[model samples]
Target: MNDGPNDTTDLFFRDATDLAHLIRTGQTTSAQVVQAHLDRIAALDPAINAIVTLNEHALDEARAADAALRRARATGGGPGPEIGPLHGVPFTVKDSIDTAGVLTQRGSPIFAGRTPQTDATAVARMKAAGAILLAKTNLPEFSYSTESDNLLSGRTNNPWNLERTPGGSSGGESAAIAAGMSPIGLGTDLAISVRGPAAQTGIVALKPTHGRVPMTGVWPRVPRRDWHVGPMARTVRDLALAYSILEGPDGSDGFATTPRGVDTGVGPAPQRRLRVGWFTDSGLGPVDPQVARTVQRAAEALRGAGVDVEEVTIPALQENNPLALFNAQHVMELKPAMAEATAGHEDEMFTMSTTMLSIPDTSMADYLAAEQGFERIRDGYAEFFSRFDALLLPVLPTFAHEHGAGELTIDGQVVDATHVQTFTVQFNITGMPALSMRFGTSTDGLPIGVQVAGPWHAESTVLHVASVLESLSPVKDQHPDL
Candidate 1:
């Protein structure tokens, strides 16, 4: 680790809310804040390969924020303490998301020269909250893979260890946030995109209920069956704050029927009595012994608290897993978009798309059946949550796997890498909220995370539980040694 004179890595490690507080208090100018993060990115990004695109215009935005602050200060009436809730906080998002005039290539050569004419709803929301867009992070092609890699941007390596992956498709965003390149970021989770990466990078991420946030300009996976726009940050509060800004219904998403009646700015407060269900294995995949142990420990901690904790099984998960169906739907829906994005580069697109579609296909009838299956699962979750306030599970079967490795081996058993996404994807399918927070580190120093599943539109419950766990372990402000 390069420790320079006046190193700002420590400063950069602050959560987004804390950073915003500093900016609002005039303790740190936005330009200085941007420069500090930029410096950290320059020094550490080489190893993590997290932030693929550095926004050269970020400093300009920072300067504008500073000028705006000065203007507000110059007024005879001093600037109101409440400007934007984000008030000059710096953040990033997956490259797959539209970032105004920036290249939103969806991590493929197909959109090599493509630039979004407008910002994605989440990006616009974040910016409106006074968050500065620092840069666009990398992802898997079309945000398809569980690992971040594309012909346009090589691969995003895990911050905990360079050779391993920072889970994807939001891998870059997680890696960047983990290494302190950016304090917080918005990451879409169709499957394990957000939680997987958060688990690997030791960050806190939330996949709010489906439609909790609009997916206006996000790259689609054909059919777009299970997907979500969520917040990935170094702390649970940061994730909650980011989610508050990003949540809402937009006129754009076709599948978004109605905006769940949840207030983004001020959500429902935490309840007095809490019931939590803890399960390390759901009979889906083999978990790393250490990951399981750490999660169980966290569950025990929660039980020790006033909250009620138990091991309850959701039977629907056993017979009707939507893993295959979800992937099939994603590939089918996005194939055309991917093809169009890679028009000039058909070969690359074909290769990537084929790699994605090669997974077992769930036919139209199969999809219809899967839809019914998902409804059952959703109902099961509803019933489960009626009894339990939250459910706990491992974010991934193991810590960060080797970058772009095809499969994951757990305790002498080889599980398909694609299966690692199974746990997180079900939440998207059920339109429920799920949170991933760093539980502990593996013997190799790689981070392991635990996921908290809450009922539909219950982001507050999920966040409250995560905050409790966060208070117990306190994973925030601990950036990688990068």
Candidate 2:
């Protein structure tokens, strides 16, 4: 590897898969890799402001990892019987997720100085896999806003332009990975938290099938059925690796339906022709022409690679409008949850939290109707997936916009900004597995990501298709200038 100025940058840029291999083979020590990231954070994080809290024991654990590798090398010719797939690699967690002994403020003064006695199930699993926790990234207050700014941790800036948002409630996690502060991370998705932020940052993120990974350690338990926790990284392969290790029942989460120890590999399966459906508009909001073209390019790329690709749309998406459906049911439900969380600390609540309180609550009748509407959407997807194996669509209707940028103007027609979640929230409602990965770039040079979603419990198919798209992507190994 080349040395000097770019050396640390090189270390941080490599995906978790490559970094773990290097560490396991003794070509590089875990300490070196971990410190390279810490050094990067020390030098560059001031401007990006993604990472909010550091793991005090990360270097110590990395050193322990290095020692374990030495012992394993002396005993056997491999990474050792004890080393897990993520052995020695460093990772970050969104603050909304718990980390034992580390501050998890949840981006609110209400949660400031709050630290858990044990890691969230996901964090513990990563630790069990030998991945060291490097830090805790920021989020919107109570993880409620589409942006990552909060009264407690301030705001996280996009690594790409500093002026644009990285997207939230997982914005800090995406921004950190994009800036090389961390290779892989853990994030939650209620609506568009993980995938949206990943799209904004030019990285890869997976929101596994609802309950595929448990929600034992994350906050916002009111909407237990809708929230999901999964992986985010610089490369699709890293996401696959993290997902394999993170999947299955934790025994504690009732929502986790997948059997324990289920790891569906991302590689090709038995011989079968896969059909992928592509779309730009979901019939809810206007999609930017560039975003539409990117989706088309991805479809054409797959077609050229010998995969069957067809332009299609789900009627339910256009009729029900998942984003609106989500708001209808969740607004009333979540407002109470937020109220409960901020009961004694009302003065500490952020604008998003207060604004949500002002919105009228849905009646039991309308809430029930919204729930039924979502079921029709689920049925619609089940029928749609019967024909296609996966979907290719835009993660965002347009490229990253300025922080708190009000109203999205698509093709000169202004629309509500929340319409950005038009494509992603559908998967959350249906409990399908979906992912975001960089495929193309905007004219102004921001990364554009395409969404790949599969039927429930079909993450392996999703990853397999994503791996192909990753190889055929028009943009690769591109990083922000931070």
Candidate 3:
């Protein structure tokens, strides 16, 4: 791993959309695009440990894409266009999501040699859209922890600071993208996986309305409703592009019942003002002052853009704690699944798997109440969105921290570390679409992200608002030195 500045050319850092355009226009070959990313992975992955498996056929696929594009050009781009919108772009996936013929270890020793016979619906969709799979990223054991570490693949370090975590269970995806090893990738968001890690790594991630992307072939299906498969990338446009491909049911994942909706376009609505509500303290815990300021700044930026941005609190957030509710519900539901997976391989369990097994299960009454509580949270967000088009809030109460952070000090007040999911898990339980993008920097110089969430199936609006914030963000094009 190179501990100093990355010496790779700008090609590795280019967004997936740009790479696709280059390939489409014959400015660059898919082979060169794939080679650039492979080179970056070879140069930087040793220190980051973000990769669990590489798609050995990636270059072959890129070559095939180039040939297809050439054929299309010769045919005058006729009849349905032989290539896809993402033709020739390279992408990655979290190890928890299956990749046909590739290892899908779920970051656990018990499933160390596991390989799926088919790609997850999201992966299949990405491939169908002409993206070459670059690699499979690391995750926490069974994607059960906030830090991406397990007995099988070790830990993933943040590109900003090696000692600090990139945030998980999608940490590997975030780290790989931030370091230019992957232009874009797919991630599974259970509680805070996709969005939180994006915040830490200063990238953009979108957890489209739950079920927008099917969770087919992803692990921990016990709590099927919350396993959201979404895209993470350096730009919001990439998220929009990927989401457009990943949505719609695959005839599996019953929760993915919503039919494909019309694309609302990610541009500003000129006829009406978009209303956005942002808040710093929603009562999850005392947030870091810097994070609070970042949220405020995002709200102000939107206001300056002619958006109706307000600082308000939701009664649902204040009355119901998503962090507590997630733990209460998932712990009981997930333990039995872990038990089955680790049955004979108990000795191979990591702290995450073992600790989960040790926890007492929730009583049936409490479990039922928690289910209702989740519904109430969903209803609250629904009511809030009835008046507002979007919401801007901190993705986490603070910036990235060192690995194994069991506790945190926010604004000089000690708080449970689990509060890290305070802002993120709300959408997880509600199945609302939310995004995490860098809007500010902390005193420690790590990127701080603000969450932009929308009501059910409102991804286009969420992306539009995020794009505006992205363009106006003061912290732009800042990559980690290494």
Candidate 4:
């Protein structure tokens, strides 16, 4: 694994939308676009262990997109124009999400032979937007762990440090983007599956407000109150673009509601100085000294950028009980789905221990009670947001943990490798929009991210603050050495 600064210019690392623009302008053909990404995936994916299945039909679609783009140009862009907003752009989907005709094991062995006959709502949206699905990336079993390690596809290594995790369930998507295997892809965040991986990989990811993106056809066929599918990309702007395409009620998924796209444009910038809350040293047990410093530096930089940065303590929110309850309820929702995904493969390596199931099962009644408690917590945040426009906090307690290692321990505390997702789950519970923007690196050189969260349905404010941080810190162009 080549670890220092990455300079894979021979590889295609530009934003997917930019590549689509090139195709639309005739600067590049879709066939060429597809080959470029496929070649890169073939060459670099081996190192990160991020890709599990490649779309064999990718080139055929690419050729069609090329023909369509040329025909559009010849007719002055007539007859339906290009098929999708991302027409011909190569992309990936987390293995947990279904792509028609593709294998979607959900990182478990029991469903090793499983295949879907229909595209997931998010995948269908991308296809309708003109995206050419390239491959399906790896993830933890049923996306239950914060670290990606499954019996079928092994583990996804962090690009920054191959020995460290990319961040779970969505690690493959995050690693693939970090290594430029694919420019942009979809990730589902129930806990921090999206944000955690993005934070560890130095990429931009968002878990849109609940019901913003349709979750139909997502495997495990479960309805998660804390999960939403969103975009993962190297640039925040690219994430915004993809989010615009994927947002809206698909009419099929009962959980999805809003169909509003990015027409709201970029929300108003903070007119008066914005009051930002920062939590560096939350007494959340042996907080990584490096993570604390990284977050502090980021907060200080935002303050320097003319924002009112307050060192406020969200103690009640910071405590894990409410978050734990929320996660337990989510686990309850997944039990049946888990049974389906793991059927007949219970004896597979890395299979869940009886103890793992017992925790959520035992907490069943408490899980329901926790659901009620979570509402109160969400209300508390609502009240807090009434005073402040956004809240800033660490995306993870520490930098990327060592890749391929089983179980994650921090500060002598054993956290469910999956449950450490506490940092990102709260915003999901409140149905608020949160952006995991790259801030800086840890002392050990792993990426550390800060969450920019806003009130429910206030995606504009969340993104506005994210854009400001993007401009202030300016970590967008940096890529990993594959």
Instruction: Rank the models by TM-score, top first.
Output: 2, 3, 1, 4
lDDT of each: 0.80, 0.89, 0.88, 0.78
In model 3, pairs of residues that clash are none
**lDDT digits (tens) for residues 274-389 of candidate 4:** 87887854544445666777678878888988888888766556544555676567666776666665566567736443335555463657776877778777777867877787
Query: Could you tell me every candidate's TM-score relative to the true structure?
Result: 0.93, 0.97, 0.96, 0.90
The predicted structure with the larger TM-score, 1 or 2, is 2
Q: Estimate, for each residue in 185-295, the C-alpha lDDT of model 2 and write its tens digit.
A: 999998999999999999999999999888998898768788999899988889888988888888899998779545443336636678899999868678888888999
- State each candidate's clash count: 5, 0, 0, 11
Off by over 4 Å in 4: 1-11, 77-83, 221-223, 261-266, 281-283, 318-320, 340-344, 353-355, 363-365, 404-419
Best TM-score among the predictions, by candidate number = 2
- Among all windows of ten consecutive residues in candidate 3, which has the lowest summed lDDT? 1-10
Residues 9-40, model 1: lDDT tens digits: 45777888887777777777788889999998
Top-down lDDT ranking: 2, 3, 1, 4
Candidate 1 wrong stretches, greater than 4 Å: 1-9, 256-272, 328-331, 336-344, 357-361, 474-476
lDDT at position 286, candidate 3: 87
Superposed Cα RMSD, model 3: 3.3
Report the lDDT tens digits of candidate 3 across residue range 1-482: 11221333768878888888877877778898898899999999999999989989999999998888878777886324657889989999999999999999989878878989998888999988889999999999988889999888899999999999999999999999999999999998998999999999999999988778888898878788788988999999899899889999889899887788754333456468888888888777789899999999989999998898888899987888888888889888788888998899988999978888999999888888888889888888879988888888899999999899899998998887788988899898888889999999988889999999888788889999999999999997789998
Of models 2 and 4, which has the larger lDDT? 2
